[model samples]
Target: MKTAGRQTDAIVLGAGIVGVSIALHLQERGRRVLLVDRGEPGAETSHGNAGLIERASVVPYAFPRGLSTLAAFASNRSIAVRYRPATLLRMAPWLARYWWNSAPGRLDRLGQAILPLIERCLDEHRQWTKAAGTESLMRDEGWIELYRSRRGLQQAVKAAAELAAYRLAYDVLDEAALQAREPGLLAGIVAGAVHWRDPATVSDPGAVTRAYAALFTARGGELRHADAAGLQQDSTGWRLSAGGEDWRAPEAVVALGPWSNDLCEPLGYRFPLGFKRGYHMHYAAAADTAPRHPLCDVEAGFVLTPMARGIRLTTGIELAARDAPSDSWQLDQAERQPLAVPEGFSLRWLHRDGAAPGSASLLTDALATLDWPAGEGSLYLWAACEHAAFRQIRAAARQYLRPEIDA
Candidate 1:
């Protein structure tokens, strides 16, 4: 391989779904793009999601605002979300900011701001799914949100009604209706469900992501596997090396998902990004044994989706470091849940060692596109991510390597 090269039009770090999609979009625009990652595309965070392009999720995920809910989580015994005691102190400010921004008016505004993106998520995925010829892996029927209590179901129905202006199609299902729709759901513990009819799902999200990456390559975009730690910027552009060959690009986007902060911190773009980790394991079951659509147990805070491997269950957030060693406590509880199935490695087993790459949940929905060399970022983004953390990260950033940030 050549030891050096002329600059490409763009370099996208992290080959997960987000990175791959960005690279494909850039390539579609006729830019010479290099998609880089240390491992195969979609083999990380992209692989472990609940396999839904949730079009019904018009409202963004907000911090829990209820006193009981907040108190319940504070004890850290909740199955849905657990946090490391050590992370609490360090994350207090971010948490406070999150709570503040979750206020009724603020959250509503944020929801409206991201309405366009949420509305178009399926259309965007369809474009790639079509281009990648992975249509066989997709299911257009969407998923179900289950509630164990009438109160829970009613709340969800009320929320769905509020979102009527968004024009999302969903049905409030009583026990009879839910059982009728998902005969195999083992709904004895469920009082009702919300059948969201818009969001499409996939059997294997990782495979779909890899297919998109493959499409990117087939369309003549360069893909490289290399450590992004070696990334450096100079007058020419941003540079990285792979196979002993130095690669340069006039522009680059860090779409590393949860791992984005790891590389961006070095580049002096560190914000107090939340590393919310979770776990997933496949259960032994066939399509007949599983529901027709992915089912989310709202009370339990997990999603059960039918996959090629079996029924894949994903747990909720565990607030911990990105590189924290895997914990068996959550997995143990997860297995004991209603959806647990008995199985083994070949065809009838469960893998106890599975963990998901944490999502870098940032307060700033995104940093406005940074300029090259000057590399100044904007904290002016409103609605979606307007909060105290913006000012906090901005103040903290100025004390670092002088990244010429714009206030």
Candidate 2:
């Protein structure tokens, strides 16, 4: 490999939001930094998510415990969860660990551990958005989770109490109140709604990521197209090939997200990393009608959020190998009843709006608003939870770079 014969303070692998954010922070601290990625920033998993910078997500997703819920998932009757048998077999050990970690006490501890970082999401993202000049992409309208039955509503309310303990604000809206706030919603369809008022949404998740990367470059940091898999260590520190030249850095960070294991495994570091694949499709709303805010169809197991392109419908998790072929069965089932759209909203509208029917947008817009006194959507499934671990990564990097600085 051709060597550039240059050294920097640090090199960050991956160009997703996590990597970009870390690079930006390091550069802000006066570290000479180089960010390497195989493709354009945020073009992978970071691009395709319900775009909520969830400040209220104090809890991580726990594995299902109820027999009925487990049965629905196993029988493939649930739209919210799907799994390939072979993938499940391969993931059994990781799944077992996840299950054990999801025990009430363990999950609660995890929540407490990550709560500080979740609380900082808004402020941290605000700083980046401001510097990146993407402030207009953000919205403070929060989200809503609608329950179809009294039991579901009650359970949600009980859960809200736990969330409230963390100072996350929410409002409970009964059916009439819910309809009043979101007239486009089918009247009387939902028993109640929980409006989370603390979080913010983004109009275009990918654009925000790109904007942050732009800030990184403008701040004198480098964004080089390179495969992180070629990273190597040397007596001086670390080196990697990118853009046909080899570069060196005293330190390196692996923020590859789902592919983080590729480099870590070869380096003999093993972490029980897992992923839940999801899908999303956008559609045009009928004339003069659109969801005011993001809404989670709790029973249906999907989300509908108003977006700049159109209305985005995001599906729930699918347990599969990282490289498994894409599956649209969940999307097909979710299309049966597209919530947050008018009665006549259909595939025709999507075709008329320039997006072909069933064409998926690799990136999704965050949340919308409602006409009611208060309305919001579910916080689950958005990409913000990953920030929890990102905080730890940042802390470790800071400590390593500034050994003279006190914690």
Q: Judging by lDDT against the true structure, name the best candidate.
A: 2
Q: Local error of candidate 1 at 185, Å?
A: 2.9
Colliding pairs, model 2: 143-376, 143-377, 144-376, 144-377, 181-372, 292-368, 292-369, 293-368, 293-369
Per-prediction TM-score to the true structure, in the order listed:
0.86, 0.86
Error (Å) of candidate 1 at residue 206 is: 0.7
Residue 270's lDDT within candidate 1 is 67
**lDDT tens digits by residue: candidate 1, 1-407:** 54567568877787876667667776766789888899998887677777777677766677888899989888887778888888878778878877777777877776665555565666677777888999989899878999988899989899889877777888888888988888775646888989989878889888987998899999998998999788887766678886567888767766665565667767776654566777778777655566678988888777778887777777788888768787756656766676522233114546534553334345433222233333432111111121111112212212222232332
lDDT of 2 by residue, 1-407 (tens): 65467778878887876678778888988999899999998787666567877677778667788888888889975679888898889878877776777788877776665555566777777777788898998888999998988999999999899665687888999988887778877765678899998877777777988988998999898999998889876667777887776788767776776676677678655445666777777777764677888888898898877767777777888877767677878877887764545566646434221211111111011010001111121100112223233222233233334321101
Error of 1 at 140 (Å): 1.0
Q: How well does candidate 1 score on lDDT at residue 317?
A: 81
How good is model 1 by TM-score? 0.86
